[model samples]
Target: MGHWWDRNIIEPGKLPLLLALAAFVLTFLITRVVTRLIRAGKGPFGNVTAGSVHIHHVVPGVVLTVIGGFGAVASGRHGFGPALSAVIFGIGTGLVLDEFALILHLDDVYWSEAGRKSVEMVVLTAALVGLLLAGFVPFGVNDLSEDELQNRAGAVVSIGVNFLFALIALSKGKARTAVFGVIIPVVALIGSLRLARPGSLWARRFYRRRPRARARAVLRAYHHDRRWAGPRRAFGDWLGGKPDPPHPLERD
Candidate 1:
């Protein structure tokens, strides 16, 4: 075990990354627990306020992120400084991303359906970082043989092709696929080859003239959402908390 750790983690200079990922996941979980408790009115924790304004955690998160980011840059790799800075950055990232919906919408949507994006982003981030920890290289470069890498042109072409597929997937509204595809090119290819989601850029531009294709795309999207939306929402609610009920005025 120690040998594996040293060879795969320490020797490879992945300790700080590992530490950062651990800190990031832990901080996010703790933040969710605290926020959930506050929402339930069962904890001493409450919103932070200054004067007439309510200060959000994102403010402090920004400060810490800047500090840790700079510190990491100055500290270099393979040291206590890097490890400490990584942890600080991870904590700050957790706080910032916890309220990503607020930043995105420029409003406090923490308990709204839109707020689910934050949890999804965090989950996606953690999964990607976990893949990195598992030594999955970006752009499928890791799959190339040493001889292929030695051919610089070939490597560049391979990466470019992978990037093209990823872009196509993104345009098709396969965000998760596009993101993961950066590390696993086959996923990107699959997403790119699949039909675009209804209302996606690919569907809007390409399927607009094809009535049959448009209908098929819409049908597929409906079925897909129906199959996963409930479980997805349930998981998000369980991990974060149930969103506040919508107001009549806010409803159609």
Candidate 2:
């Protein structure tokens, strides 16, 4: 284990990245706990207000992100400075992303269904970072042999092809597949081979004339959502508190 750590993490100067990932996850968890407590009116935590203005945590988050981002660049990756900077940046990122819905909608949406987007984004970010920490390189570049890597034309072609696959997956509206496909080309290839989402650009452009294909896409999407939606919502609510019940007028 120690040897693996030295070979994979220490040698590659990934300690800071590891620190950042830890800090990001911990910060999000802690923030959720505090917010949940505040919502329930059962904790010492309360909203920060100055006169009539409400001060969101994202304010300080942006500040910390700037300081830590520049500090990390200046500090380089070799020393304690980089590690500390990573932690700071991670904390800022957590705070900022925690209210990502507010930034997206230009309004406070915490505790609303829209707020769940923040949780999804945070989870996605953490998962991607975790994959990198697990030694998955983007675009399958790491899978090339020393000879192939040395062949500039071959390397470029490989990367370009993989990137094209990722792009196709994205066009199909398989975003998660596209993201993971960048790290593993096979994943992207699979997504590219699959039917596009019904409302996606790929479907609109290609499936429009193919009534059978369009019908299949819609059916697949319905089944897929039905299968996963419940579990996904449960997981999100477990991480961040459940959203408030819909208002009467908003109810379908």
Candidate 3:
């Protein structure tokens, strides 16, 4: 009873969950505000990205990371003991989400150079590995208890979900976006499948969206490719072998 009270008093897990949800909502609100602010401040034609890095990427990411990290700590420490392990693991998970957001924002603003993209892949892979190893470290500080382990696993799952969301958002256009977009979601789907173990709540939720997401992907592909109405036309005859369709939905 005392332990329960202590856990509730010191760091209630529900608080973290509520905080995480609030952060998500706030981020969305901020996005809308920033969009309007940009339109008003930059003028209709002013470059939103011209010569300056916007806080949109950094601010929301920082807020989200904090929310996620706190939630992880709260959940893991529910029973008792220090939640440091949960916090550490949670932070790693938060980092992954932030990284995903950063990538999405970066892609939206500027195409990554091949070399830079490669470096990104390497760095992320390293970070994940390091985080996993940290969980297993046997420092004098409390080794991760069972709840902490579960929280760490949950954090990993959370990151995967965030990655999927990023993929869906980024792959939301025709042709050029389609080319890269198709590959990413498929990979994400595979990851989601692997994460979806029996009785895992996160896995269940992730799987639920798979079909709709796939449908969206198909529509995006068709929308982008439909612009190339005809086949094998000479290059100079029209842009990219065909004129842009009046609209992607207009069928022959």
Candidate 4:
């Protein structure tokens, strides 16, 4: 185990990344537990406020993030300082992403349906970081042979091709595929070659003139949503807690 760790993590200078990932996941889980307890009115935890203005955790998160980010930059990739900075940055990231929906909408929507965006962002972030921890270099460069990488032209072409495929996947609304394709080109290639989702940028621009293609896209999207929406919602609720139901006054 120690030999494997040395070869995979220590030798690669990823100890700080490992610490950060651990801290980030733990912070997020702890924050959710405390918040859920508060919502149930079963804990000592409560919202922080100053007079009439509520102070969100994101405030501290921003401060810590700045300090830790700078500290990491100054300290480089080794020693206790870098490790501590990574932990701080990860904690701050966890807190900030916990309220991502609030930041995005510039409103207190943490308990609303819109709040699910936070969960999705956090999950995506964790997955990407996990992939990095697993030694997946971005843009499929890790898969290139040493000889190919040594050739500047070949390397550029490989990276450019993979990135273009990822962009195409994104335009087709395959966000997850596009993101993961940075590490696995085949994923993006598959997504880029598939039918675009309904209402996606690709669909809007290209499918406008093709009724059959539009119809197929819509049908595929409907089936995809129908098959996955329930499980997705359930997963989000399990991790982030179910969103508060709409009040009668807000209901149509």
Instruction: Give the whole-model CA lDDT for all candidates, comma-separated.
Output: 0.93, 0.93, 0.39, 0.93
Better of 2 and 3 by TM-score: 2
Worst 10 residues of 3 by lDDT: 235-244
Q: After superposition, how far is residue 151 of candidate 3 from its true place, in Å?
A: 22
Q: Residue 72 lDDT in model 2? A: 97
Residue-level lDDT for 118 in candidate 4: 92
**TM-score, cand. 3:** 0.27
Report how far off residue 167 is in candidate 3 (Å): 16
User: What is the Cα-based lDDT of residue 39 in candidate 4?
Assistant: 89
Number of residue pairs clashing in candidate 1, backbone atoms closer than 3 angstroms, sequence gap of 3 or more or interchain? 0
Q: Write the residue-wise lDDT of candidate 2 on 1-252 in tens digits.
A: 999999988999889999899998999999999999999999799999999999998898898889889989999756689999999999999999999999999988989999999999899899989989998889999999999999999999999999999999999999999998999899999999999999999999999899999999999999999999999999999999899987899886
- For residues 1-252, write the lDDT of model 1, one tens digit per residue: 999999999998889889889988998899999989888898799989999899988899888889889999999885589999999999998889999999999999999989998999899999999999999999999999999999999999999999999999999999999999999999999999999998899999999899999999889999999999999989999998899998889997
Q: Count the clashes in each prediction.
A: 0, 0, 1, 1
Clashing pairs in 4: 139-182
> Which regions of candidate 2 fall more than 4 Å away from where they truly are?
none
Evaluated at residue 179, the lDDT of candidate 3 is: 26
How far in Å is the alpha carbon of 7 misplaced in model 2? 1.8
The per-prediction CA RMSD against the true structure, in angstroms, equals: 1.0, 1.2, 16.5, 1.0
